[model samples]
Target: MEEKQIKTPHEVIASGGNVIKTRDDHSLILVGSDGTVLNSNECSWISDDKDNAVDNKLFRSRIEPWLTSLFQSEHLSLLCGSGITNAISSLAGAGTGTTMGETTFTNYKNEIVSAAQESAQASGREKGNIEDQIRVANDLLRGLKIIKDQNAAQLEKELNSIISNFAKSILNSENGIATAEENKRENAYRVLVNFLLSFASRTGNKERLSIFTTNYDRLLETGAELAGIHLMDRFVGNMMPIFRSSRLNLDIHYNPPGIRGEPRYLEGVARLTKLHGSIDWIQNGGEIRRIGLPFGAKAITPYLEAPGLDNANTMKLMIYPNSAKDRETAEYPYVELFRDFAASICRPNSTLVTYGYGFADEHINRVIHDMLTIPSTHLVIISYNDPIGRVLSFYSESAHKDQMSILMGGNLGDITNLANDYLPKSAIDRATIRMAELLQHRMGATSGLDKQATARQVSIVADVSTSEE
Candidate 1:
């Protein structure tokens, strides 16, 4: 038997000739000014006293503070992909959570299947997922209607059935989350709360965080509620929230009682945009709106399923997965949603952080690519593995390599490990930041003169620490 060959990080880097990519062997890797690799010597990382060796701690120490500073950028946005959904789904929910799996019926009208396959292949996918099927079906349905084809009604019926099942599956997946307590195998919920709060916890002075997700699940909403974070989105309404094209650029703030003329932005308020549309969103009488769906629901909401209503059918779920569709539809919500995304991240001093995103969506990736055109804007890619070489390819093709930061490997991408080991506390104290600066100044002033004794410098550090406490 022959042993399979696996390339080391050094080999991967050399093969690309400076286009460093994520390692497939699950070795810890970092790219950028703070780059590090923890591969070749796993044995050395183990010791009698410590589970994670001193070197491992050192690697983490560098990245954590660096990430902390990046999160405090003038404009910050987080883009989430299906990686997060899979991470959450791994937990032991009471019932099977939403799987967002492939279409149940492989049997499609021969022409329809051909078009769908072509659509999937155009995007580099081997076959269309449920979203692809749905979009293709709709497009085909429209064409048939235009030509007055006799099969239009039949295709519409199948499309409706596919959508009904898809929406119900989404509801089921979210409901499964409610059945969970603490998933003992991996407490993803605990880490999820921390992961969200870490980025969302801006002081009143910084720009409000913008969180966008391709996922249709409501995990972010649920997580925000649990963390006591306020989310402002484009949808307006309470009973049945309508997606408005034009609304005031509103925000949440509070005024300190003693200070009459000034107001402070409320802490932890982030603008949420579901770029691919959400499962809860639907179109009724030519207007898009969000319906009330409880987390971990037992059935579709009565408000949505009411028999007489035009959109009472679950087929109206606003998830627009098939990107191949034309963006010219009347009142198209995706264009509006994407405009929010582009406007949020493509500005000066902006930082976009991606978690669990595989970079599969070309539409989203194009915006990211354009954002990097601005020398000041930055991107941070954090994922367990590249799966395909998309992550590496994006890095190599970028004109501004210095503006990108990447952390890849299984340990770094795990929600729990990322939250606990890498993320800084929710709020880093301003006084502590100042005290460190003071210490650095003291060290610089005393370095060359003190060769034998360091008592004075040590005292200065202690005094600074005492002041911080």
Candidate 2:
């Protein structure tokens, strides 16, 4: 038997190219050197036989130490990958990725981690004091920010260095492993999608579904798309381009150069709201633009850099690290969306299922607290590190004592328990096991109902019988 070839990161990068594309099923497919297609089938090995488990012990054995090292190291902070922002935010001190503190901490941590890793590599086994390294990293990060604020063009070179350093550290770490077979990326993606679907389905009473994430990657969108759901991001605009066209017709139908419509929503899915911008989004002049998935569709052309911070007008929409108050302004569509989403989900009888998201952001924390205050609302938080019930215990307040439930295991079975314990048993039957499932089921049903009603001749039908009667 011939031994299969294994490619190293150096070899992959040196080869000069790789393509990270989503498969038809919404799972990621990485095309590396020599046309190697790394898909879910190849990557699912990390979980052993427990394919549906979120926190596979074997998987964690590889992930935990890598993550712990990254966090503990003084040199690395911002870990950017496809849909990684929210996950990073959850692990950072900020808890919630959407909050100002969480966002800032993510950037800060990235910078620090970058510097520390560089120093460690250079020192070569002479372990430095973690605190000292953190201080140094923080100083460097602050200095980079100061340079940016001063609008020093030369400072960009230094900023690039900091960013590059952080990237290198992550790439060197185990978490940086991108290959399907090595990283178990497929399992993680599956778990995430399943959780979202189930949560959305379980909360049938929710009129609208809102998701706020800091991840720049397309995993969530891809997952939603595969599951036949529509996603909306304030920065990205509406997923349903039809709505954009309708709005444009009201303003520019008679204009000389015909106005191009924005992205539209999916027919049946709930709305997707991205708090941070997406990787595919671009900014030009002052207008934000996005790439079209359709083959013949013209790429969106913006007047400004798609989401550049250098442009004063464009900066508002960009997800830069800052304080909570800074994020509440209307100019920052993402921030506004976050606030609105919080209000919507915090209503009475609402249920929020937070999976990988840790309560790190104070802004999001406040929102959660508000939700907990509602008498009818329920909170279900799933974490591998802590039991679900105990996880909610961390947010202890006089009012929220009995309001939240925690599912404290690492498997999908825990999710089943979490849903059953917090939600009425009757609700579980209608509940989904993944985010995509809920979006598909709800959107499909709603669309069908709308069509059926519109097809009927009678405008109004009186109910002749009632259960009470």
Candidate 3:
């Protein structure tokens, strides 16, 4: 009998298994039917081996037919997950070890150890003091009580401070956002934003642009503003935008005085909905309000304050991890926000393109599945790893497979690049013009790119132009 050859991680996943990365960035382990490690690569998460790249390319080519179907749909919505945010930071040379996904227990553990060591040395305490602090952080990470001789309250405060600082680092005005990154070429956030803007601008005036995000970070908002695209979020007014669910349904229009003048659309290319509440959002008198702060602020504390209280509202309004997330969504603004998300997905002729969002949120997963029942609704899920649960089930089902496309082990650049290429001529043209305008801004030129240059770039790359050279 002939012996079988060892299969790569991608091959294992393609043959119906999962490729999960271990915490230590050690290996790409393949999980089997019974949830056991069937195989693993003693290498990086993104392998540089020729065989892996070839397999990825081949798999992508095989999925082109499905991609075509998704692109041809009338409406498009995008879901940005933590994975894509990490990709943005990595590509932008702005990795502060502080994106949403990097704020895990493991990362926090290391941070705690370093801080404890420094504090002990500065206080001239014995070496064992550092070790004692280390033990506290480890116990907290493992969901256990602090060891004897350590103050529980102190340890808890330290833990919270570490986590809060990590989140704040990722949200810092200077280096936090993905849009602040210099290079637009490899920046996934820029590419995704451009794709969203293109679809929203070129689509029919009545057709709504739906963008829903589970992340609390401002990557999408930052990118949208830099690109001169307006997001129609529930919050209105510059100082403090009050959150009203009804406002999401409103649209901005401009009507000229002349009888023959057609009403022109002014703002709101997309309905930017953050299902999970943001750091800037605060609860005031049973309602949510967006607090605007000056750039380069130190922390979340000094900015948000309850009425007539000396202390700041220290409650960070973010839906942190799983299980607890369900409970959090039941709260004030989240309930209203999620309701809009579900409604948007259910709309006829709507298509949602999800990036990096693992179908982990059960509430969101259920609504996505329910939306599929609508005949014209479509879903395109693109993630760095194989999708789990209902996402996998729906992708494998032959009945609705045509209406859905699941591209695993793919980057945001890949999905956006292919979709932009496959979009209709009108969308591609509009996107090219918009991209050219952005490029001109980057060059510090006062005037916009001429139609001749815009048309040339639109036909070629959709984003790149001769002026960029």
> What number of clashing residue pairs does each candidate have, in the order they appear?
3, 55, 0
Over all chains combined, what TM-score does candidate 3 have? 0.61
RMSD of 2: 17.6
Query: What do the candidate models score in CA lDDT, each in turn?
Result: 0.68, 0.37, 0.54
Task: Provide the global lDDT of candidate 1 against the true structure.
Answer: 0.68
lDDT of 3 at 302: 65
What 10-residue stretch in candidate 1 is worst by lDDT? 16-25
Q: After superposition, how far is residue 282 of candidate 1 from its true place, in Å?
A: 1.4
**Between prediction 1 and prediction 3, which has the larger lDDT?**
1
lDDT by residue for model 1 over 148-266, one digit each (tens)?
Answer: 99988887788878787777787777765666665542366777788898888876667889999998889899889888889999888787778887747789988978998777678
* lDDT tens readout by residue for model 3, 95-133: 532433222234456665565555444333323232234
TM per candidate: 0.80, 0.45, 0.61
In terms of TM-score, which candidate is strongest?
1
Question: Can you write out model 2's per-residue Cα lDDT over 314-347, one digit (the tens) per residue?
Answer: 2222333212233332344445555655755666
RMSD for each model, in Å, please?
6.9, 17.6, 13.3
Comparison by lDDT, 1 against 2, better one: 1
**Candidate 2 weakest ten by summed lDDT:** 459-468
